[model samples]
Target: MVVAACAAALLAGLTGTAHAVDNLPPDQPLVEDLQSGGKPCATGDDTVYVPTPPRLSAVLYDPEEDNQPSESSPLSGEFEAWWTDADGTVQRRDYSTITLSSGSRQYWTMPSDLPADTVISWHVRANDGHATSPWSDDGNGSVCSFVYDDTNPEQPTISSPEYPTPDEVFWVDGVGVYGHFTVDSPSDDVVSYTYGFLGGPYGTVTAERPGAAVTIPYLPLTSGPKNLTVRAIDRSGRSSSQAQYDFNVKSGRAPVARWKLDDPAGSRSAAAETGTPARAGIGATFGGPAPTGTASTTTVALDGSGHGFLTPDTSATDIRDTFAVSAWVRPAETGRTMTVASQDAVGQPGFTLGLHAQESGALWSFAIGGARLSGGAPETGEWAHLLGLYDAETGKAHLYVNGHEVGDAVAATPAEAAGAFQIGRARGTTGYRDRWHGDVSDVQVHDRVVVPTEVSEHAWRKPTLLGHWSLSSATDGASPEQSGGTPLHLAGGASVYRASDDSCIPDIDPDCTYVPPPLVGDGHLALDGESGYASAEGPVVDTGDSFTIGVVVRLADSAPAHPMTVLSQAGEHTDAFKVRYDPPTNSWQLVMPERDEAGAPERVVSQITGADGGEGPGQRLVVVYDDGTDTIKLFLDGYTNADATASLPDGWHSSGALQIGRGTVGDGWGEYLHGDVDEVQAYAGALRDEDVLGLGGETNPCLC
Candidate 1:
C-alpha cells in the first residue's frame, strides 16, 4: 500500500520533538520514508495506517539566536546576520568567539583593539562530550558577531548645462549656477545639502546645507534647451539621491563696437576737454538781441551756433504751475528728432521728451500737459540717460530710461500747459521748430522730481564743474567777490548772502567798494510834502535772519488816507510788522507795531482788510518772514495765501533797510513809493515752502 503511505508521512514530521529517555551515543541513522517494500510499514492493506516514530529528543541550549545586542553606530558600519536553526548543528562551545580585523572586511577603525561596541558569540556543543542521545535533549548552539553601523558616503549628484535650443546663438548664459555640498558621517560624521530637481529648468534640492552640498553650475547657455538636477545629502539635513539632465543655449550679440573717428585735430582736443560754462543773470544784457520779443537762447556748443537752446515763458507761468526748466544737451547728430526737452504749445497740456518723428520713424517719446508716452526702443548714437517726470498729486507721468522704468502715464488730472518751453525748439507763436539736432551737455531744473538713480547716475557721470554763478555784466573778469549774484549754496548748513544794491562796490571803505543803497520806493516813511528827505528816513532794515521780499508796485497817483506801510521794526512800536494796502477796504493790511509811551511801538493793527480786486502799476508784492516763526505773511504774484497773525513776536532790532515803498521814519505822506520799484530781494531764511508755494527754487538756499 505504498508502504503505508510512506510511514504515514514520516510520522507527521515528528511534531515538535521533546526527548531525554536514555544515553545513546554512537548511533545516527534515521532516513525513512521510502516504501513499496522497504519494511517498517506493511501491516495494513492498500489503505494508510502507520504511526510510531518519536524517539531521540533533549537538546536544550535554545540560546535564542545568541542573546540579542545591536543598535549603535558611527565608525565604519555593517553587521547584520540571523539564524534560528535552518538545519541545526551550530557549535563553538565554551562562551564561543568569532572576531575579525585582518585587512578589515568592510571599513572600520574606531577605539581600536576590537573595541567600538564590539561583541561576538557562536557557542554550541551538541555531542562532543560523553553521550546523551536517546532523543538527546542536552545539546546547545548560538551565533552573534557585532559591528552595527552603516558607514557614510553620499553627497555627489549633479546633472547638466542644458537649455538654449532654437539653433542656439547667445543672449543669456548661466552666469549664476546654484551651489553647496559636503559628506563623511558614519563615523567621520559631516554631511549636508540637498535638492532634487525643482521644475525642469532646475529645482528641488532639500536639506538646505547642514554639513554642505548643493552646487549647480555648467552654464553655457544662449537662450535654449535646458534641464538640470541634483540631490543626495544627510547629517540631519537628510536627502537621498536624484540627479537629472538636459541643456543647450546660443543667441544675441553685436553691442560692443564703439566709434566716432575722423579727428578734426582730434575734435579740437575733444573740444577743449568738454567745455561748457557760461551762465548769466546778474544785471544780464550782454550786447545786442534779447528784448525784441522777450527771451530766447540756446548754447552749449560742439558747433551749431552754441547755446544749445532755451524758450521758457509760456505766457509767464503754466507748465502746470510752480514751474522749472533745465538744460545741457550733448549729441551733435545722434539718431535725429532731438529736441532735448520741449513744451509743445497749441492750447496747453505741457511736456515732450527727446527724439520723436512720425511716418513710423524715430523712437523715444514723452508728453504730459500735451499727452504722449511710449518708451522701450532707444539706443541711437549712445550717450543715453534721460528723465522727464511730472506729478500734480498722482496724475503720474514718467519716462526714465537709464534708471529703469521705461514708460508710464495716468491722468485724472495732468496735462495743463500754456506754450513757450523749448530747449532745442518747439515753442510757438509762429517760430522755432523742433530744432534739437545734437550735442547738449549738463541741464537741470527741479521744482521737484529728481529721484536719485545715484542722482541720475551723477547726472550723466561727471564732466566736472561744481560751482557757477550768473547775473552778468562781465565779472567773467573775475573778482567782484559778490556773494548774492546767485551764489547762496548753503543748502541746509546755513549762512546765506545777497544784501544787494551793488552789494559792496567802489568806496564803502575796506579798499573802496560798497554801493548798497538803491531801494528807493518809500525810503523809510515820513514824506509829507516830498523833497525826498524825511528827516533822514528812519526805519528800513534787515541785516540778516530769514527773509524774502520782492517789490514793484504802482498804486498811488493820489495817496494819503492811510494807503501805505511795509514795516518790519521789532523793538517797540507794538513790535512793528506790517504789510499794508487798504485804501478804505480795497483790501490788504497786516500792521501791528505800536508801544511808544516809553514802552516803544507807536502803532498796532495785526490783520484786517482783505479784498483783492486789482490795484495797478506792474503790481507785484511779496512778503515771507519765518524768523523761525512768530507769524507775518502775505503774497500776491508769488501765489497768494492771504490772512495771518499768530501773536507775531520775535527778538528784533537791526533797524536797517528792508522797509520799502513807504511806512516808517517821518512818515511824510508815504512818498516816493507811489510806484515803480524793480527786482529787490531779502532772502536770508524763510523762502522754501516750495519757494512759498509757487512750486520751485531751492537749488540750495539757507536761513539756518
Candidate 2:
C-alpha cells in the first residue's frame, strides 16, 4: 500500500513538470535563392553555359535565430538540394553542417558525373533538425536552370574578295597588299575570332552576337606566300579548330632598265636585259667576278681613270618625279668621292648614287641636287648593294645598303637632268669627276620609287653560299656539307649528337634564342679540348674578301686553363682568322694575324668582354669582315658588340684547310675548344647588321 502511494505521487510530479516545459517548434527556415558561379541562377527559359563544373550556392536565413537575443541562438544545421532534368529525372543531395549564423551563405559544386550540354533545374531548402524550409524558387514557384557546355565552338569560315582563291597568286598593286577578310562561325555560340598570319602574332576581333560575321583588314608588308589562320572562340572561352587560308602575293611593278653587265671580255657595249644598250668607255673592262658567283655572268671593272664609264641612251636621262637606282658595287678605293651612277645637271649632277667624302670618312651617299644624305661608312674592296630612291609624294630621298635602310630619309625634290645616264662617273663643276674605282654589276633603274620590300628583294638577290657545315648527321666520322661543299672530317673524339631540347621557333616557342636552320636538322658536333677537331679541304672561304662566318656554340667549361678556339682558317704559317674564347679576359675574340707569314709582330684581335662565355645555353657568334668599310665586327646573339669592333683594312688569303674546334698557333693547331658547335656558315659577302640579328633571332637573314 505504501509503494503504490509513492508511485502515484511521482506520476503527479512528472505530469506537472511536462505542463511547465516549452514545446514550440523553431520558426521555418527562410530559403532565399540559388546561385551558380557567384551569379544568380538563370530563370524562366534562359540557360547559362559554363566552362567547368558549375558551383551552386544560396543565401539562407532563420527567423528563429533572428528573434533570439543570444549570439549562440540555434540556426539551420543542414541543407537539401533537388535537381530535375529535362526528362523529369529527379536527383537529391544533402549537405550537413554545424549550426550556422542567422544569415549565412552556403555553396555546392556540381559533380563531374553531370551530363554536358544538358539543361537542368535545381533548387535548395534549409533544415534546422526540427523542421525544414520550403525549396527556393524564382519568386514564381519555378526552379532556376542552367546548361553544362564544355564543347568547343565550330571552325570559323574565312573569305576574302581580294584573295578569293587559296591556290591562286595575287599581284600587289602598290607598296603592300590589303585583304578584307570576313570571318563567320558555323556554331551560334561563337562570339569572337582569333586570327594571325603564320609565323606572326595573333589578334582578336569580337562579333556583335553569336553567329554574327566580323570583318578584319589585313595588310602584308612583304610579298610572298601567305597563310592566315582563324579560330572561333565562344563565350565559354573555348577555341575551335583553326581554319587556314593560303595565298600568294607578288610585286606588280617592274624596273624600267635592268643591266646585268654580263658582257664578255673585249665587248665594247653592255646590253640591257630590259631597256636600251649602253656603250662602255675607254677604260671599262669586262670579265670580273660577278655578285652572283656564277661563271656565266661577269662584272665590269673600272680603273677610276677618267674614261672608265658607261653611257646609256638619252632615254635613260628622263627623270623628273619619283625614281630609283640600284647597283652592286665593289669599291677598291676610299677616302674620296666615288660615283656608281649619275645624271648630269648644271653645276652638279641631278642625282648621284655613290660614296661621299666627309671629314669623318667616306660614307654611302645619295644626293638630289644639293641635298646629300649620307649613310654608314663605306668599306673599300667589299661588294655592297646600294639603292637610292626619290619619292615625290613624300619629297624625301632614301638610301639603302645591303637590303637595309641606312640613315633617316631626307626631304628633297628631284633635280632636273636631261643628259645621258652615266655609270661609274658623275659630272662635277669642271667636268666628269668622281669616277668609280672598282667593279659594278646588276644595275637597275626604276621609273617609280620602289617599295622597301622590293628594294630588299633586289638588294639581296642571292647570297653566295661559300660553305655550310650543318654538323647534324655524320657517318664514319665525316659530316656532310649542305651547300655542295667539302665534307668535314672529325678527328680525335669529336662526335655528332642530338640536341637535348627543341630549338627556339618564333611564334611557337616562348624563348627567343635563335638556332640556325642547319642546327634544327639532326644534331650538333661535340669536341674534347685535348684533340677533338674537324677539318675540311683547303680554302673553304676567301678570307681576303668581304665575308661572313658564324656558328652556334656552347662551352663545356666555364673557366678553362687555356683559350678555346671555335673556328679558324689556317694559312701556310698561321691562321688567317680565328673565332675563339679567351679565358684570361673572359671574352670572345676575333683574332687575325697582321700578316700571313710567321713571326708577325702584331695581331688584330677584337674581343667582346663581359659576355656569357661559360657553359651556358648556346649563343650565335658571328664575325663579319666588311672590306668595303674596312671594318671587322663581332656579334653575339644577333647584337653587335661595339666594344669589340675594329678597323681591319686588309686581310691575306688563307689557302690551308678550314679548321673547327681548334685554331692555328705559330705553325701548328692549338687552343682546341671543349664544347658543342653547330650551323657553321660562311658567306662570300659581308652580311648586314639586320642579317646578323636575323641569324640570331627568328628572322631568316637569307629570306629577308
Candidate 3:
C-alpha cells in the first residue's frame, strides 16, 4: 500500500506531496536571519544599523530523517548581543532562549538604550536534536551598529531678517516690544530659536511661526544701544547662522542682558552683549577651586567636578507674561539631577531649567521649574536641544526635547526672581548647588511664547539620501559602493551587463537612488539556464532528509524541453533532493525521495506557486523548501501565495555535486533550466517568509 501511494504521488505531477520520515534524532538545523529572498546578505549589507530593535531567523530540520522534525527533537535557538561598556570596555549579553513556533522562526530584540555609535555583535545557533549547529554567520553577525544618526540636518535659513535693512537702524522699544526676526528653515523642520544682541546670551524663545521674536524687557529705568542677534534651530539639532541687527534701546526698560558664556578663560564675566555684559558678584565666579569652565568652541563644556555660573550685571530679564529659556545640553551621565539655567533668591519661589530621573525609571525627566512637573523624554549621553517656555497669551507652559513638545501645562512663569541671576547652577537660600554637567551651549532667553512648529522643525533628519547601487560597471571583480559605505562584491564572474544609458533603477523603488544601468547589470551573477550553469563544491545534501533551497531567477523567452532545474543535488540513487520548475504548470516543485516507517523508499513531491501563477520571461521567481514547516513555498516577483507540505524521507548524504541550472533525474541528468538565473542559494534549513521575500526582491534593507 505504501509503495503504490508513493507511485501514485509521483504520478500526480506532485505539484504537492507529503508522507513522513523516520523517528530519529534531528540533524543540525540550518540557520539564517529572516529577510526577503531567503538568501544571506540579500541586501549585501554586513553592518546593519539598528536604531530601535532588530529581529533574527533560522530554519530547523532532522536531516537524517529526510528533513522532518523528530517528535523527540523540537527546535530551540540562542542569541547574544554585545556592545562597548560605559567604562570604555566591551560587554556581551546572552539573549533569552527562543523556541521554534509553528507559524515561523524569528527572533526579536529586547528594548535597550544602547548609546549611539555603539558597535553591537549578535549571532544565533539552532538545535533540533542532540547536535547543535554552530552560530549562523552568513555575514548576519558581521556587525550591528547601535546608531542614532549623528548627521545633523542642513542648517536652516533665516529669511525674514534683512537686519538693519538698507537705511534702517533698529531700536529696542519699551514695554517688551516684539522685534521678531522671521526665519525659514532649509530643512523646513523648525523647532525653536535663541536670539538677543549679536553676542548676548540666554534670550532664547520657542518658535511659533517662521518669525522668532526678540523681546526687550521694559524696566522703566534703563537705556543704551543693544544689538539683536537671532539663530534658527531645527529639530535635528541643527542651528542656522546668526542674524544680527545692531540696535539702540532707550530708557524705561525692565533690566535684561544676554549672558553669552563665550568669554575667555577666567574673564570673570559673560561675553560682551554689545551694550552691557553681566559681572561676577561677591563670591559668584566661574569655576575656581574646581576646573574653571572654559569656552567649548562656541559654548561651554562644564565638568561635573566644579560649580561654575554667570552672575548677570543685573537681572537678565524680569519674569513676565511670556518667558523662555533654551540651551543645548549634552549630559555626561544620568542619576544626579542638575540645572543648566536658574534664578533664585534666599528661598521664596524660583524656577530652573534642568533634567532629572526618577530612581526607578530608565528615562530622564526634562523638568522646568522643579520636581512638581517633568517628562521622561530627553535622551541621555547625547546632545539635546531643550526649550522651556510659558505663554501668557495661551495660559500654557511647555518643555521641548529636540524640538518636540514633551510636556505642557496650564502654568505661568513667576512674576519675579531676586538675588543674582545664574547660569549653569541653581542659586537659592545658602548657595550654589545642582550644577550643570557635561557640555552646554547656545543658551538663549526670550520674553514671549515659543511656537511648537519651530521646535518640531529643529528635529528633522539631515539629508534626503536613499540606498544606492552604482550600476556603472561591466567587468567582474570590481566592487560597487552602496549608499552608506558597504560595497557589493562581485563573485562567480558576475559583471555589470546592462547598458549605462537606461538600465539602473532602485531594485524596489522608482524614486530612491536610481542610477543608469551598468554595462553589465547590478546582480553579481546572471545565468542562461541550460547551456550555462554554475557548480559549487558539495552542499552534500543528506539524502532522504530535509533541507531548503532558495533561488532568484529571471526567465527569458524560451520554454524548456523539460522541467527547469533551479537547484539540485542528485546521483543515480533514490536519495536525491531537487527543487526545479515545471514549465507546463508554471510553478516550482520540490522533489525529496524519502523512506517510509517500514524501510521502503518513496518519492515525496510538493508544488509551490505564486498568487499570480508564477511568471514568464522578465519576471523573477523565489522558491523555498522548509522541513521545519513541512512546506514548500513559492514567491512570484516578491509576492508569496502558494505553498504545500513537504514529505521528506530518511537517507544518507547525496554524493553528487551541488549544481545550479541542471540536475540528474532518474539515470539521465536532463531537467535543464532555459532562462536567466540571477541568484542561487541553498539553506541547509527552512527559511522564514521575509528571508525568501527579501531575496525575491520585495523589501530593501536600511542603509543607516
Candidate 4:
C-alpha cells in the first residue's frame, strides 16, 4: 500500500499537480503613517513639529504558511507596541483580541491627556498564530522617538539704545545710522527671533540660548518715523505674538551732498543718501565692494580707461570756503598722481584729495592749487579712507589717512575755483589730469570743515581685531598676539621656522600667479603630522555674530588620509567652525555645525581641489560670516569661490577655546594639521574684499 501511495505521489508531482504547503513565518512589520507630508514624524535629532494627539500606525506583513486558500488569502495577525512617555513611564498595547489582515494598516491614537512637550519613544512587532516577527526600530538599534509639543513660545521684547521709544524722536549723527536692537524672550524654548521694518521683508536672528538677549544691527534707509515688529520662535517651529517697536530717525548734521554710489548696474546716475545724485560717465561700472557697512551695497569702479568720472549736481559745487571732501578709495595703480575728488578751477583743481606718487611710495594727499600736503604710504589695490579738509579760518589744508592726520597741515590760501564738482579726475594745465584708476564709494561733501572727531568717525570703519597672531616667533612655548592680549600656547613639539620668500607683487608682477603664494612674513609655526598644535584660552571670536577668520597654511601631505584642520573653535560637542583641508573631496572646506549638540548635521562649504594648488605651498584661507547678507563666504588666496558660498541665515554661538592645528571629532580632539601655519587672524566683523587682499599682501589691516 505504501509503495502504491509513493508511486501515485511521484506520478502527481511529475504531472505538475503536487500540493505544496506554505511554512515560512511573516516578514517584519513595516510601520505605516509614521510620516506626515512625506517627512518622517520621528527624527534622529530633536522633535518633529506635528499636530496634537498624534496617531501611531503600522502595516502588518505575513507569509502564508497554510495550503488552504481561505486561511492564506486574508491572513489574521496581532500587533504589539511599547512606548515610554516623557515622565519615564513605560506602557504597552496589544491588538491580539482584535482581528487584523496582512498588508493592511492599523492605527492607535495617543491619549488627549498626554502632557505638552512629552517625548514618546516607541516600537511595534507583529505575531502570527505560530510565529512572531522582530520589532521595528530606527535602524540604529534605538526605538523610534518624537516629541509632542503644541505650546507656542511667549512674545519677544524689543528695545534699542539708539531709538528707545516710539513716542520720541532719536537724533542720529550720520546718514547711515546703525541702530542697535535688543531682543529677549520670556520662554525658555525660544531659539530665534524674526524681525523686520514695517512693509519690508523679515530677517531671522538666532539666540545663544533661551532668555539670552540678541543684538541686531539695523540700518535705516531713510530718515523718518520707523516701525519694527519682532516675533519669537521656539525649537518646535512655533511663533509667538508680535511685538511692535516705533522710533523716529533724524540726521543731526546732514551732508550738503553725499553720493552712496549704490545704484543698479549700467545706470547712469548714482543716488545720493542726503542730497543731489551724481552722474556716471561711460567707463564707470557699478557693483564693486563697498568700503564699510552693509547700508552701502556697492561702489563705482573706475578702470582709468576712458572718460570715467562721477560728476555731482550744482549743489556740490557751492563749497568754496571751509569745505571737506571725503571718500573711501582703492587705487588700482599708484605710479602716478590719482585724483579721487576735485573741483574744477581755471588752470588747476580747487581741492584734490587722493594719492600722490612719491619716490618712497604713493602717499595720501590733500592739495590746493599750488600747494600739497602728503603723508603715509597707501598700498596699491587696497582700500584707504581719504579726507581733505580746507579750513579757511586756519588758512591750512589738512590731509587724513584712515582716521588719523598724516603730515603737518600745509598753509594755503583759499581759491574760488567753483566750477563743476568732479570725482575720479581733476583739472590741471592739461584738461582732466590725474584720473582715478580704482573703486570709489561713499563720497561726501560738507559745506563746513568737519572737526577732527568727525573726520575720525568718517574714516573709522575697519573691523575690530579680536586676535592676530603673526606666528613669527615662539617664546617659552607661546605665540604672542600682535594686537590683543590673548596668546596661543604651543604644544607637542610645534616650533617656528623662517618662512619661504615669495616675490609676488599683487596686480603688478607678470609672473605672479593668482593663486596665493607661500608665506611672505618672517617666520611660521611648523607642526608634526601626528601631534602638534596651538591653543588659546578663549572663545577668541563671537561665532554667533558677523566675524572673519583667516590663515595661511601649507600642508605637509598633499593627499592626506583624512581631513586636516588649520584652525577651529571648540563648542560644547563639536567645533563651531573649522577651516580645513578634506581629503575625501580633495578640497578646502569651511565647516559649521547646524547645532552645537553632538551628532548634529554639518554645513560644509568647499572649493579648490587639493590637486589644483591647494597643497604644497602656503595658501591664504579666509572665512567670513556676514549677518547682514545672511551668507558664509570662503576665500582662497584673495579670491572668492562662488561654489563654496552658502546662505546661513542663523548662527549658534560657540563658547569654547580657540584651537589651531586641530579640530573636534566626536567627544575627542582630532583632525590634526600636518603643515605650516602663519598670519592667523580673527575679527569681530565681516571684512571687505580689499581688506582681505591687503592681509594676503602682508599689509597691516589696522594700518597703525
**Candidate topping lDDT:** 2
> Any runs in candidate 1 off by more than 4 Å, and if so which?
1-299, 302-338, 341-365, 368-387, 390-433, 437-561, 565-579, 586-686, 690-704
> For model 2, which pairs clash?
379-628, 379-629, 380-628
lDDT of 4 by residue, 52-171 (tens): 656666666676543346564333444344557666878665444234677665565666665566555656666666566666663533355556668888888888877777455455
**Candidate 4 local accuracy as lDDT?**
0.74
The TM-score leader among the candidates is: 2
Clashes in candidate 4: how many? 1
Per-residue lDDT over 275-299 for candidate 3, one digit per residue giving the tens place of the 0 to 100 score: 2465543223332221112123445
Q: How far off is residue 12 in model 3, in Å?
A: 83
Rank the models by TM-score, top first: 2, 4, 3, 1
Candidate 1 lDDT for residue 36: 14
What CA root-mean-square deviation does each model show from the true structure? 28.9, 15.0, 33.7, 27.3
Q: What is the C-alpha lDDT of each candidate?
A: 0.36, 0.75, 0.49, 0.74
The TM-scores of all predictions, comma-separated, are 0.23, 0.53, 0.35, 0.36
- How many Å off is the CA of 597 in candidate 1? 44
Q: By summed lDDT, which 10 consecutive residues of candidate 2 come out lowest?
A: 22-31
